[model samples]
Target: MAAPLDLDQLQTFIAIADTGSFTRAAEEVHRTQSAVSMQMRRLEERIGKQLFEKDGRVNRLSEDGERLLAYARRMLRLNRETIAAFDDRRLEGHVRIGTPDDYADRFLPEIMARFARSNPRVELSVICEPTVNLVEQIRRGTLDLALVTHDDEKGQSEVVRHEPLLWVASSNHAVHEEEVLPLAVGRPTCVWRRAAIDMLDQMERDYRVLFTSWSATVIIASVISGLAVSVLPECALRPGMRVLGESDGFGTLPDCRIGLMRGHTGQPAIVEALARHVSESLDNITLPASEEAGMFDFAAMMAMRPRRHRPNMMPGW
Candidate 1:
């Protein structure tokens, strides 16, 4: 008869995989480093497969370890769901989550507040990064969930919300009319940046990249300050910004999509619950029935603001 696998050891294994160091894994799992080491030793013996290997100063997963990771995540997720199905108390635990600065500005506040109220015991550890970095963290088992910009070429994600991508410039400035147009955009890997450049190239428009950054604040600031023009989501329409259209020589842009990605660490109940909240929260972000014919006004959405304090850097939603 086959021996049963140990759930405690599996949990410890996942911690080590996430941290990439026995010491850090020990801190995360609340066990001594030696104790964590012993658990891995036993885990390897139980499965008769070497799981870890030495890499410079940190531990790296061996080929077999990578295979086990998926199974371990699945088992742990199932166990959590089973417990949650029967537990009488409110759901609890930590959720390591992330999103790019753009979404962080628009979606996170309400989602955070709603999630906290419903699951007060669930601790939220958040990070703000670009989609590439966020997806990398998910692959490394560091992030439980992330709201990201969805692009097929960058990373695969379950798209949750779609918003029209629009070009905008300062309502009071003529920056967009510069013969050699100055533009502020995200890093080279950004899909929005690629789209802007591609359209310009097709139009044979003279242009120059005046600023490149992964930060939405920096890009948006450049536009508001009349330093450069930029493409932004509908929700990013600030008070001084005006949407550009065909008459302005800027072509219509496709919809920008928001997606969710998860890590192998599998906090399923917590992650899925948060994912639902994220989707529902984005549904509240609405634009006028038609694009505004005048300078974009953020105050028009004031009625949509939640009856709560809005965080700095948060967008009007």
Candidate 2:
């Protein structure tokens, strides 16, 4: 019989992929860096496939590793479901949750669906809003839990993930090279907007707010049409966008931390149960470094271009 894939090893693999750093992954798994490294090697041997490759100092998932990710997530979900099914407590209560709109499509559906399946009696009320609004609502006790973005390093809350804030533009846009950067921003309270403006000010770079909206999609659309460049979480980046980095003469932006925030009062059992599910679901979510160029028609953007422009000096958004 083939050697069974160990759950511990798979969990460690997921930690590494989620954080994109072995040291962070080790911290997450409560293991030494060397121990984690050894586990990865052993896992690769058991599977008869190399799982990771070095990207600079970071280990990016290899092609085989990417292929394993889907199966791993499904298997882990099944494991969790089985365990939940055996639990004696059947939780049933209304849990009001809030999240930034950007994450609504990415994680909310799967998380809520899983929770609904396991706790059929529980009622979930999900509200999609900006992080700022969610934070306030959570503080005011209008929300039981919220997924928020903060810059706190001392870990004042339950940190979910650290997403790099990226400057993105149309694939064929060379706006980064222009003297006055045209910025497509969201609401004034948007975290990315604040960070982008602050970074530009600190760098003494000239920038003009060419467009503003409350929607990330609108900002992204403006970017796709080469109207302006905008800052977004790395995971929010799609195929038609280009992510600007150090090589592109862009200043570094702070990492936006996605964390769980709860109301001042103690959480009810059902709320606590939902929070745990949210943590597990989010922990398993690993975003691709950059989507494939062909995923979105590179040709469509090119053909619609009103003017000749140079290729962006960064990877797919």
Candidate 3:
């Protein structure tokens, strides 16, 4: 008889692949790092294939791991649906969902698509804006729900994912090697922009803002063309960019908290339902740690991108 796949191990595998580190995976699953490591070993043995490979200090998904990721996501989603079919309550209402363009590009489509399938009556209207503006909109009840990137540890926002800020530049461009670092920054209110500048100031490093915009694509384009470097969450690392670490002489940056904020107190059920769905969907997101490698499907991300030009800044969001 063939060895059966353990759902727990499969979950662990997805977490590791998603987070790009066993340590982060352990945090995700609420297990010790050693325990996560053990689970991976057992899972690989059962599958009879290596699932991850070492890339510098991080463990990247192997080709087999990448292939398994697709299956794992579908299986887990189906598994949740199968189990919820018996007792799942129908969720219905208008949910005004808002997020920065970058996150909307990376994770929103999948989340919204799945939510729509599960709750056909739930009307979802999305807004893409800067985090600072989005938070204000949420507070004023202009938006029912928002996902934002924040550095506040004391805030009441329900955190979805937490990761450190990473210094990123195009792999083809050696922007970081310049004496006076050029920066492709967001608007003045951007948390990532603030964090990056503060770190540079503390380090007494010289930097010049080459470009500032609310559009993430513009910033990425600047970096890709060797115009400047930018700080972003680990999840934003794409195929063309590289992550700069301490060894690269960049000062450490503060961690970012991506969280959900509720603006309207009314319709608790719908808000909670969407909030729960967002949490579950985000939990499965796997961002590449650096440019030379990533387990995520960039093609899927490209496909999910909306046709029209949308404001696309907000690093942590």
Question: Quick one: best TM-score, which candidate?
Answer: 2
Worst 10-residue lDDT window for candidate 2 reads 308-317
Task: List model 3 lDDT by residue over 82-180, tens digit each.
Answer: 655555576667889889876888889778977876677779999999887888898798888898886474474777776666788777868898999
TM-score of each: 0.64, 0.68, 0.67
Candidate 1: misplaced stretches above 4 Å?
1-87, 287-317
Tens digits of per-residue lDDT for model 2 on 1-317? 88789998998887776666777778899999889989989989999998887655455678898788767867777887778777777776678998877777778877898888778877888998877788779878899988877646334357766666777888787877889999999778676788999999988989999999877778888988898989877557676787776667777777767788877645477777788788777756655325444644334323222210111111110
lDDT of 1 by residue, 58-123 (tens): 456788987897688668756755665565786689999999888786678888977776677899
RMSD of each: 16.7, 8.6, 9.9
Pairs with backbone N, CA or C atoms under 3 Å apart (clashes), candidate 3: 18-286, 216-312
Q: For this target, which candidate reaches the highest lDDT against the unseen true structure?
A: 1
Higher-lDDT candidate of 1 and 3 = 1
